[model samples]
Target: MSLNPSPLPDSDFTASGRRVLEVETRALQALHDRIGPDFAAACRLLLGCTGRVVCTGMGKSGHIATKIAATLASTGTPAFFLHPGEASHGDLGMVTDADVVLALSNSGESDEILTIVPALKRQGNPLVAMTGRPQSSLARLADVHLDVSVPAEACPLGLAPTSSTTASLALGDALAVALLEARGFTAEDFARSHPAGSLGRRLLLHIRDVMHTGEDVPVVAADVSTAAALLEMSRKRLGMTAVVDGDGKLCGVFTDGDLRRALDDEDTDLHATPISALMGRNPKTIGAEALAVEAAHLMEEHKISALVVVDDQRRVIGALNIHDLLRARVV
Candidate 1:
């Protein structure tokens, strides 16, 4: 056989893709309509579970189960995926009495899942069954059954599990979200579960975590010369320096932009002109406790690249630039 196969006409390919999407979309609509008392019961079982939600399934359903478990876990509900096949062997030990078991099976008769249903019952774990067949064995035995039956499969031959799997995944998402809302889950709660993700960095990272402090902060006395402030900026490599009064409180800020303006005036002497003469008074500042993403927004709003981190007294405690945010991966 040749490795390269003849391709179908572009129109034919697009028609087939559209057909599949239409079938899945219809399936999702049916699933949405079917959400009622049964769905509520399933959510109640999961929410009442004191331990963790253990999702189990076989084959294509298993993949969907894994994703559902992850969604639930990241949204304030503690959950994990367990392979039904493995559970029949020994992984069943992972499911405790306090855990709620969510089993997915299109036909609701997967042998791997069926074999463990009796053990789950004996362990006193609540079982929530999601299946395309309401009268199937697994559904009948479940404490709560969620009907995910679809009108048809997306495959032309109706042999693939496309529509059924899509409906199951959507239903799982609905359950997770319902539980999340019931538990009053917040973005901060979600971020805790995803600390390594971009959302986590945006929500959890504060200015204190990324700003340059103490010696690393570029600072100069308000009475210092423009040339002296330039030296401080170069030494700190922050492209800006905070100008403070004798009491060490922030009075103004002198940046590269200021130097440019000062140089434009031939009458201004870099060495003799005090920074206070050219610095921006009441410059934009942020508290160290503020979110780092807030700093990014403040900089964008002002069309500036750096900000001075200040205290209640407007003392320059730290400084940060766009580069610092980039290095921290918060930008």
Candidate 2:
């Protein structure tokens, strides 16, 4: 029945991880220096692309190419991954004159990738290459060459793609982030792309989306007795009642805390006292268009659980408590 897990010893495994990280770190440092005019040119080409940025590679490079394409696509650049082997096998039709091809080959000599280069050129598609060798065939043929070379692989045998792959992936991120900023891709744009994510929900979920509206909103006329306001609060179960003017514009709020203070006044009668006299004036409020997180922050800052939602004309349109935000997963 025990659920606690035993700790594993870290001596040898930790050493290997440190070695791999150190190798990749050095590779990234070297890549930082190589980012010059060529990197900028690659960004410009991708930015100006009218069609998809088709990414192609072989073996390990294919995996990196897939990630790069995904990053580019998510960051506002239209792109996709195409296997070089498949390109010659009928996927070649995916390439078009309006598109740009971003080919990845650490050696610039992948037979599968090279086989499709001539056809791509014939189609008048621009080629952007990421390779370790500056004079690589792929590099020489590319309209823009991104040098993603590393001094050595994290692998002791120097045969496995390790540091090289890390450098390529990092360079891909640099291209994506640069393009995202250059295109003015905003948080709202990112939210649109990631609607199901928590960040997207936080940014896109407005107060109006989660607030209690219509009959669910707890409201009482300013002239109503404190007892009547309590009845409205109890009926709505929102912990507070919004006191409104004759025009249904919000004037103040009466909460359980306000009632506690009113109770301390021996001369006050809850049933006879006007709600306006006991209510807190200029209560914290939020517009229906505001983000839910803003309401959460306001609630935390003011030490209040509920917020009255208003329209452009400051008319009470809705109300919401912290629980509503929690239910909406905005908190």
Candidate 3:
């Protein structure tokens, strides 16, 4: 075989890519149209399984099976991939009576998968088969068969698993999503499983988790001098200070912007002016339990850099700024 093959024309490359896409698109459409009673039956079997759904296959089918298992596991279903070749070598012990077996094979006669079918049947595990051939042995033994037969292979030689694998993957995603909806899986539920992902940070992180509490919160009495409020802001490094009444209820907020404006006023005395006189009243506030993403939205909407976290009584319990959110990776 030549290590350096002649490159095809750009037009040829583009045409070939489009042809493959068209073939796979048609295959997916057929799979979609075929969804009816059997698809629902497969979903029902998976939903009712008391234990995990064990996905098994070989070669290209095995890669699709692994992806399907991951999708199912992440979307509120407990699932894992079991390689068929490994199953006969004592890995069959992983399957239990309660597990639901999802087997994948385009021809539906993969020897490794068939070898484990009898053991699965003896254990009373429900079998769901995804295959291109309905009359094949694995499909015949399946309690529910999902037909993923494509009209043709996307490969020019019709030897590679192209359209068939695409169809199978789409069918697997359909099954996982149907089960996800049936289980009423929410973003928060998904976030819990993907705690390190961006969605998890946005959904699971709360203001309380990132806010500065106690003495770290910049707060000043409403009657304090503007200089005193500036000191509080400087100490907390939050760019603003919450001005509260004698009862510790939030009266207003004094920020760096407010100070810059105060500096422009010739009559204003920073040392003598009370913070209440310089503060901006009815400032934006958030509850400590609100999602950190909500705080980011609030800040953006109000065009402010920080927020005072308050309770029902409007007492300042915490404070946070844009930098805080950035540090927490919630922004």
Q: Report the number of the highest-lDDT candidate.
A: 3
Q: Compared with the true structure, what per-residue lDDT tens digits does model 2 show for residues 262-320?
A: 99999999999999999999899999889999999999999999999988777899999
Sorted by TM-score (best first), the order is 3, 1, 2
1-331, model 1: which lDDT tens digit per residue? 8788658788998899999999999999998888899998988888898999999999999999999999999998899999999998899999889999999999999999999999999989999999999999999999999999999999999998999999999998999899999999999899998999999999999999999998999999988898999999999999899999999999999998988998899999999989999999979999999999999999999999999999999888999999999998988
**How do the residues 100-164 of candidate 3 rate in per-residue lDDT, one tens digit apiece?**
99999999999999999999999999999999999999999999999999999999999999999
Q: Is candidate 1 or candidate 2 better by lDDT?
A: 1
Q: Could you tell me the TM-score of candidate 3?
A: 0.96
| Overall lDDT per candidate, in order of appearance | 0.94, 0.93, 0.96
In model 2, the Cα lDDT at residue 55 comes to 94
TM-score of 1: 0.96
What RMSD does each model have against the real structure? 1.5, 3.9, 1.4
* Best-to-worst lDDT order: 3, 1, 2
Off by over 4 Å in 2: 1-9, 260-268
TM-score of each: 0.96, 0.92, 0.96
Which should have the higher TM-score, number 1 or number 2?
1
Q: How far is candidate 2 from the true structure (C-alpha RMSD, Å)?
A: 3.9
Against the true structure, candidate 3 has what lDDT? Answer: 0.96
Clash-forming residue pairs, model 1: none
